[model samples]
Target: MKALIPTGDPAEPVVLADVPEPVPRANEALVKVEAFSVNRGETFKLEAPAPGDRPGKDIAGLVVQPAADGTGPAGIARVVGHPMAGGWAELAAVPADALAVLPDTVSALQGAALPLAGLTALRLLRTAGPVLGRRVLVTGASGGVGHFVTELAAAAGAEVTAVTRDAARGARLTELGAAAIVHDPADARGPYDIVLESTGGETLPVALARLARRGTLVWFGQASRTPATLDFFDFFDGPESAVIRHFHYLDADTGLGDDLAALVRLTAEGRLHPEIGRVADWADTATVLTDLRDRRIRGKAVLTLS
Candidate 1:
């Protein structure tokens, strides 16, 4: 079998090399991967990869073998799966609970884009409770998860304000249902009922200050790679009841298979769109990863088996 493995070389971080095939556990299904998406976090790991690290998370494929425990989709089924690692390979052993059967309406590329980013958006909105008629702000609105957050939040009846500096992305964000577009968080109108913030550093505090009374600010990522410094007194200036919550997509009690099914259903219904900014053959994984790390790619990047 061929898989992408970390080379521990900064100049060439990942390389396609022959590797032993994965043996699935009783609760895991063996998938023949057709496509997979690259994420920002994976790019960071490639920068300082450890020996024997196989990096991949989002995969879409055919289930060649079902779990021995009789869970997950039965027979040969088209599915989207969230594996912890080693998805960038000819095959992957995915937990049955993390696999979702995809409708014929959705393509492998779209399925590959849904797991991590889509789940993050879905779970975050769930955590925020009902958003109907509320004021919602999505920072880093042009990225994969941010794009999903903007669309899903708007669809749920929230008046969504998306923050992104790129003119091109701003235009697309508007098309995706963002009610307003701001170049920076500082420029956005405040008293937002809910805020989904990923860009860290200065943007975090600015977004925090805009919260409405009892508003919740969900912090998910620090794309800027800069630490945020918040003054304890600043909390006094905002709504006294406002809350700041840290979010991790996997922490939710909802099963991954169920959440992924929701996302896939929405895509099939044309209610959600996965913004695929780049697509390439798996042979070019290294180059595609470089572009992702440099921020040259705007949304999810998918690589096909070719």
Candidate 2:
């Protein structure tokens, strides 16, 4: 099988190489991947992609081999899931607990876009508790995970405010339920009950400061490529102290599979829309990776196997 592997170098980080078929464990299923999406974290080149390091997490495909112990969904079902490794390949070995069966109405590409970003947004908002009638702010509102966060927050009845670099690019955000779309993060009113921060760096402090007293700020991504520095007063001078929490998709230990299933169902029902900025074949993996790394794509970038 042909799989995408990181070259362990920044100049040219990923490459397409022929790899062996994955053997499933008792608790794992082997999926014939139909499509997958690239994530910003995968573009960081944080570490060298060792030999056989398949660098994809979100995948939508068919279950070629079910878990031997019957712990996984039976083989042959179309599913959307997060595979810890080997997701960028023609075949992936995913834990049974990490995947969910896709509804008939959902396509492979849409399913591919759901697992990572969708799950992240769902988990982040859940941390903020019920968003109904609460002031919710989403940064990087036009990006992958940010898009889901925006839509989910709005759908939850939160008074959603989306911050994007380009107002023109956010027309769809209003439809997704954004009460206000501002080009400048500072332009939006602050003291929000929940702030979903995907843009780190200088934006971090601004987001933190915008929180309502005792509000929660969920910091997830650092697209700005700048370090976050906070002054002493920024932390304690406020009327009431706010809380900053860090969220990672992997740490979502509870109901991981159930959440993915719900997101897929929502999309299938037309209640949730996972944006796909671009779609290309596996042969164009390198170019897609470069585009995502450079912030050239506004939404989730998907790659198809066929």
Candidate 3:
């Protein structure tokens, strides 16, 4: 099998190389690589791709090698429920219990887009505290996770306010259900029920100040490539709190299936529309990695195998 390794060296660490195939263990499944996508949100921003270090985390593949142990039979791994080494090559070994059954309507390329970004969006939607008819805001609305958050919020009947940096992309964000699209959230008067933040830095403080009293701020990944900092006074500015809360997806202890369930239902029903930026083959994993790090991607960048 071939894999793109993320080394400490950014200039040359991400090149591809052929490696031995992995075998499934008890409670594990060897996924015949079908599709995988890039996550420039966290891991890549921290370190460059090194040898043997696969950077892509989201995957969509078939179960070829099931575990010999009964702990897993059809061998499936989940998107973010567990820490599977991640999907970035021709084959990936994951715990059988982790994967969810893919419906016929969703393609492998689409499945790969679901796991991480989808789950993160789910968690944010839940953290948003319900949107039956409330107005909500989603920052970074055109990117992968942002798109999910935007669509999920809209389908739930909330008037979604999407914040985007580019004008051309802002036009399309309206198609995703954004009531208003702009380069910055500061331009909008909020008092929103919830705001999901993918863009970090000074903007986080600004988002909080715009929140309604008792409003919640559900933030996850930071894509601004700036160190995250916040003023406690700013968070407590509202009659209750300008920013009532915060959340983290990188923490391994949080359980988010309820959020994922919400996403699965919407996806299964076709209420949610997934926007794929570009689809690449498994052999092109290195290119996907480079494109994401360089921020050249238009939407979700996926690598397909099957």
Candidate 4:
């Protein structure tokens, strides 16, 4: 089998090489991968490549073999999955619980784009509780998860303020459902009921100060790669009982399959759109990773198998 393996070199982080095929566990299903999406975090890992680092998490494929434990979809189901690693391969052993059958309306490319970003947006909204008629702010509102957060938050009736420096991307976000767009988080008006922030660094404190009373700030990523500094005085002037919560997509109490199914359903219903900014052959995975790391791609980047 051929898979992308880390080469331990910064310039050429990964290379397609012959490797042993994965053997699925009893609770896992073997999928013949059709497409997979590249994420920002994965590109960071690629920068400091390790010998055994496998760089893939989102995959869409056909279930060639079901779990031995009799879980997951039975009989050659078309599915999207969130695997721990190695999803870039021609085949992946995915946990049954993380696999969701995709509707015919959803393409493999869309499915590959859903698991990480879509799940994060869905769960972030869930953590914020009821968003109807609330004020929500999403920093780093131009990326994959941010795009989903903007659309989902707006669809739930929240007055969404999306922060992005790009005018073109902001216009698209408005079309997707953002009520307002700002070039920076500092430019956004405050008293927000919920804030989904991921840019980190100076942006985190600015977004935090905008929270309303009892507001929840869900911090998920630090795309800027800079550390945030906060002063106690900054919090003193903020709303009462403001909460800052760290979010991990895998921390949900619900199974991934259920949430993935919901995302696919929404896509099928034309409510949620998977924002795929780049599509290329798996042969160009290295180039796609570089584009993602350099922030050249707008949203999600999907690689199709030839």
RMSD of each: 1.0, 1.5, 3.3, 1.1
Best by lDDT: 1
Q: How many steric clashes does model 1 contain?
A: 0
Clashes of each: 0, 0, 11, 0
Q: Model 1, range 84-110, lDDT digits (tens) per residue? A: 999999999999999999989999999
Q: Would you list the C-alpha lDDT of every candidate in the order shown?
A: 0.93, 0.85, 0.68, 0.92
Q: Candidate 4 vs. truth: CA RMSD?
A: 1.1
Q: What C-alpha lDDT does candidate 1 achieve relative to the native structure?
A: 0.93
Pitting candidate 2 against candidate 4, the one with the higher TM-score is 4
Model 4 clash pairs are none
Give the runs in model 4 whose Cα sits over 4 Å from its true position. Answer: none
Worst 10 residues of 4 by lDDT: 6-15
Tell me the tens digit of each residue's lDDT in model 4 across 1-306. Answer: 999887766556678999899999999999999999989888888777665878789999999999999999985999999998999999999999999998888999999999999999999899889999999999998999989989998898999999998999999999999999999888998789999999999999999999999999989999999999988887977879888999898888898999999999999999999999999999888888888888899999999998
Q: Residue 259's C-alpha lDDT in candidate 4?
A: 96
Q: Write the per-residue lDDT of candidate 3 for residues 190-306, one digit (tens) a residue.
A: 878777777788777787777777777777756786766877765655537455456755453344334444455677788876678888766665566667777777668877664
Better of 1 and 2 by TM-score: 1
Q: Candidate 2 on 46-135: residue-level lDDT in tens?
A: 245655566889999999899888876887999998988789999999999989998789999999999888998888887778999999
